[model samples]
Target: MAADDHEFGGQHTDIKLEIVEKYLQRYSAALHTWCDAVWYIDAFAGTGSRTVRVKAKEGDLFEEPAPEYVEQRRGSAKIALDIDPPFDRLVFMDAKPKHIAALKALKASYPGRDIDVVRGDANDLIQKEIKWDGWKKTRAVMFLDPYGMEVEWDTLRLIADTKAIDVWYLFSLSGLYRQAARDMSKIDATKERALTRMLGTDAWKSELYSPIPPAIDLLGSLEREDVRQRAADVAGLERYVRDRLAQIFPKVLDPWPLPPKERPQRFSLFCAISNPSPKAIRLAEDFGRSIMRSR
Candidate 1:
């Protein structure tokens, strides 16, 4: 039976297809040769399907693209990972039971494909046995999209230190900033710790003191354009800590840096990281620009 295309919907759009496409393009460009394997891990794999509308250039008409259509087209780069059970694999993890089950069912329908669906907390699961053999010195993209601020800092640190995986994470600053800024004392310690870790310092509190325009101003002053771009770049860095991550991992490749106008959301931020390769950053910028153009 052919695999179902509309299996993972009703979930919010974390990072859109354009961003993923650019990452794939950049990763492919940076590699000297075809990669031995590549892993695309989705930590919050919704129902495994989504429906999106594309506007027609001529008319007010909009066309809906099936989730499978988008996945299959952009997923070509993933063929090696799925074929022959290549050491490279695509892993989808989600805390939700229904989402996990749906992913498992979808995997079953696609025989000979090496897609692993696990039900568990991504933070805890990363600590478990994971085969990084194929990932060593190779590129892997991990999509970290949590519902809110629940993602653990430890997990991000572990992944960052691995030097193997380039992270594309979604940090919902609007949600957390609104909640935490109201009463710092009332916020959960874990959430506070996670925010601190994400920012790489307690200095974020200083934003309240400065007359500058919110968090974007502080982030933009950093020497690293990647850091500055991520913060003040099109989507607004405070929405996500692109600048902070770039600051913490300065040794890694600098980001391509998107202009504010190119980002998808006026209030959100999106960026990418790779091991000592500007390819990821460039791709991220291209993706960001594409998203803006699409709008």
Candidate 2:
């Protein structure tokens, strides 16, 4: 996914949106001063608005359904466009035709702005198209907000290899919890493939899908308890992913486990900046500190 690819549900601080807006506002100002062009790339970008089903309260309607439907929120693409002193160019990518059509319509709303809508898998398009050009003397922000394990590790490595873009990745820790079966051997093959893709390795099966050893009881020969260690939040996944990111990006700003309200069940936004400046570092650290304070 290129941009605005968040899954809708429950309550949120809307911090995810806040983070994007803040970063863009800061990034645009910084880039505009020096860089000839700045690009905003949103992969896995969803349609402008999603039709959400909301519970209808009492006295709400003449004959409203129990769950009322409404188009409630603006997607990232729209939000990014709305930012003042916007990026010099914007790129939107998605696998859905409807989303592509929506993006095209969105393009119409801002007639003169430079925007490109690539209808295809974000992983492939990013590696083949976006990453290849527009990066010379250009600073770019790529928001990879996929709904699932659509972002491949190889693509990330490629981005790092270029070392010209900043990445805002939505890591789905909840998906890991779902696939991390207690009995690892019995996990479905398809899910296993997804886990491997997300982790960029098959070793997670051995690394994370294991039980915590039993502690010694009063009787030395017998174990005290059978305590099975499972995926709880983003500990295992975060460490592994961040370690990999560290190998590439010098600065990986993860205001991780994000505050619960903004966190999607177990998902969090992770940022990887290629070659960060002092101001970028300041903004990233400030954001993390703010989130921690709120927590």
Candidate 3:
């Protein structure tokens, strides 16, 4: 792929980017008064831009149709840099080397901005590397747009412990349902471990599944299938995730459902407030709710 060509989608991608951008613009401006420094952290920062393919419509009989091509669009990292009252320090982390290189180039483009591009897993980087308690008077907004189950529960706990950062988590509802397979026996050791780690609890086995209804066997005996199946549907699973987040964060706003309108729920966009103060929580909730409702 080209340097500026990070993988992205169509309408949903545009909506996700817009929500984050709107929140960042408000976040920086609001915190500038009380807080000395504000930070913007993009956990899975993609090249600071993305390549979107624009499809062409059918042309009239009089003229030939236009061919489809690529277009460069700003990702969350670039959006953060463009905010009116910009963040004091911006950190962009990605596991890919190419993405890191692209982020570096993006940093170079903004000569005066304070930007740090790190190459590492978001979970390990957030959990082990960064100093959470060191931020005394500083506040931050960390965006977690992970690539399928990458954000561990431990990482979220660490972010919450900071007590000064707001989180915009783009959680994969589909990813969770898929990992926790419907057939209980289908969950292998690897899948089991992933579910527990991502959820921070082994209780999912009980919470998400149940045994099937009893059925009559060929031998004319009532038989119950020993294997369990996933009981929670998509909306139920989304609620479970929101509840999990609420346990860690002081406040979690109702998720903005993705693939908008009547489509099946694929991803859920959540805004969680880590700040423990009552006043801070209230204000963050208000801001988050307004932004989501507008979208």
CA lDDT of each prediction against the hidden true structure: 0.53, 0.72, 0.87
Which pairs clash in the backbone of model 1?
7-48, 7-49, 8-47, 8-48, 8-49, 9-49, 234-260
Clashes of each: 7, 7, 0
Off by over 4 Å in 2: 1-9, 58-69, 130-134, 211-234, 258-264, 276-283, 286-295
Candidate 3, lDDT over the whole model: 0.87
Candidate 2 residue 96 Cα shift, in angstroms, is: 0.6
lDDT of 1 at 123: 77
Q: How many backbone clashes does candidate 3 have?
A: 0
Q: Candidate 2's C-alpha lDDT?
A: 0.72
lDDT of 2 by residue, 1-295 (tens): 2344444633432567667767777677777888888889898777755444455755555854454544457777887888778778999988988789889999999989999988998888867865555566778888887775678887887877666788898877677777866655557899888878777788776667556676776767656454444454456666777776777776898635545554445776788887556765665567556545654
Question: Each model's RMSD to truth, in Å?
Answer: 10.0, 5.5, 2.1
Per-residue lDDT of 155-228 in model 1, one digit per residue for the tens? 76667666667676666655545544433444567766666665556665443222322333555764422211
Best by lDDT: 3
Better of 1 and 3 by TM-score: 3
Q: What TM-score would every model get versus the actual structure?
A: 0.61, 0.79, 0.93
